[model samples]
Target: MEDSVFSLIRTKYNTLSPTQKNVADYILSNSEKVILLSIGELAQFCDTSETTVIRFLRKLKYDSYQVFRVKIAQELSGETTDSIYEEIGTDDDIADIKRKVIQLTISSINDLNNLLDEKQLAFFTEAIVSGGKAIFIGVGSSGIIAADAYHKFLRLGIDASFSSDSHIMSIACAHARKQDLVVAFSHSGESRDILESVELAKEGGAKIAAITSYPNSSLSKSSDIVLLSSSRETKYRSDAMISRIIQLVIIDTLYVSTVLKLGSEGIKRLHKSRLAVAKKKT
Candidate 1:
């Protein structure tokens, strides 16, 4: 089998340029050898320039071409679909656990590209771009993703902050208004504290957006928009593991979308923010 690397690219075929399309065509058909191809080798094989290969990778949202190759190799290892998430039994071996986590996280992210809705993504992004103040709420694992997201928005000069503590989120909701945005991050979508704060913000007329697994859960029901993600099932539900990785992927997607909407101004703000802190790096 060629693995999903072929189907994934073909799904986005029309969007690729002439050069990138050629590269995609070659890769999709030759996915087996793609694992061993470097960026230059790939470009040569496709009769395109290295720059074209990189641009193709950028369109796929990969940080670097190397990571893209690694993902392809992982996919070919035969664990993308079933058996991606293995049960952590009482006597699970270290090697098996490592492979399970690696395959599961990759599979989770790949599934997100399909699970997320384009219209909903655009609607919330439009809201954020239209001067909507945002407050992100999450606890424990979700909290870390929210915090990182908060930092990204802060650097881009967006009016947003992350609140993990129940008390702080409640306080923030008290002051929230109709035009503000309340983002609830929960994998299970059943957090009592998150639901309570979401309800409070909803009463204040804030535009609520939720990033959670269950679309019919309280957090989802209370929110004006829900950005759904597929949470992998495991023996025990824990933090800083598989689901957190999916949450972060969602966060990065939103951050990139926001940056694209903000355009040049967002880039300048990010550069300036980095500069302000760069002096402290000594």
Candidate 2:
């Protein structure tokens, strides 16, 4: 599903131009007043022209400013979740930072647990159990996640590859078959290279699953199923921070589910793999 107008504005604010951001900032900070503010009035408040204000509305996927204001007003009618990380200030002492971090992690994880749809999850799990190769694709921090998935799923006796490099991902997709599974991870779901590879693998007849924060993004659109990850980390630290823990948790869930589906045979595979790794430790 597409995000709400308020969410779209918050998520895309950084991509907006300076003038457009001016309008965004005002609307975000003054949502209640926007319900009564005219186009000219909002423009004056943003210190931008009326035309720019209209463009900002259009950017939010609203055809007009009035519609945009109405959406915000409607959202105001319901309660919204507060950002769990709001209390974690940069200037806090070490102990305070640690406490806030733990508190936020517990709250965000609980929220994510409640938000996940069982039907959507089952679709992806069944795909993995259907006897095909699985390819994991991600970049940067998400690459670490994809790599971790590679280790976990491979232990279940599935044919899996973790491709972090863009070129390698494209190559993997090039060789992907109809039964192959391509799972892409990108928090923004807007990573150009990842999107390109996913699109290619999709065309090549691979079933795709997207794990991301945004459900309506391009990557999600390409996937056969989506596993949404919800996080509330600080803006700059989102990709590399506690969100990664949530993602890992998602992978762990998938791992255990697949193991259960594979049943007794899956345990044997895991034991064998564990023994091989144990030999290395010796």
Each model's lDDT = 0.77, 0.78
Writing each residue's lDDT as its tens digit, candidate 2 over 19-127 gives 9987876776677788898999988888889999878877766787766777777777764432222445567888977776776566556656444678878988899
The deviation in Å at residue 279 for candidate 1 is: 0.7
The lDDT of model 1 is: 0.77
How displaced is residue 247 in candidate 1, in Å? 0.7
Backbone clashes in model 1, listed as residue pairs: none
- Residue 65 of model 2, lDDT score: 72
Q: Which stretches of candidate 2 lie over 4 Å from their true place?
A: 1-85, 233-236
lDDT of 1 by residue, 1-282 (tens): 433653455335445788998897677557778889888889899998999988888777776887788777777686446323345677768897777677666766776666678888888888777787889889988888888878888888888978999999999987889889988888778999898888888888899889887666778878788887665445653423656777777778888998899899989988999999999997
Score every model by TM-score: 0.69, 0.70
Question: Number of the top candidate by lDDT?
Answer: 2
| The candidate that achieves the highest TM-score relative to the unseen native structure | 2
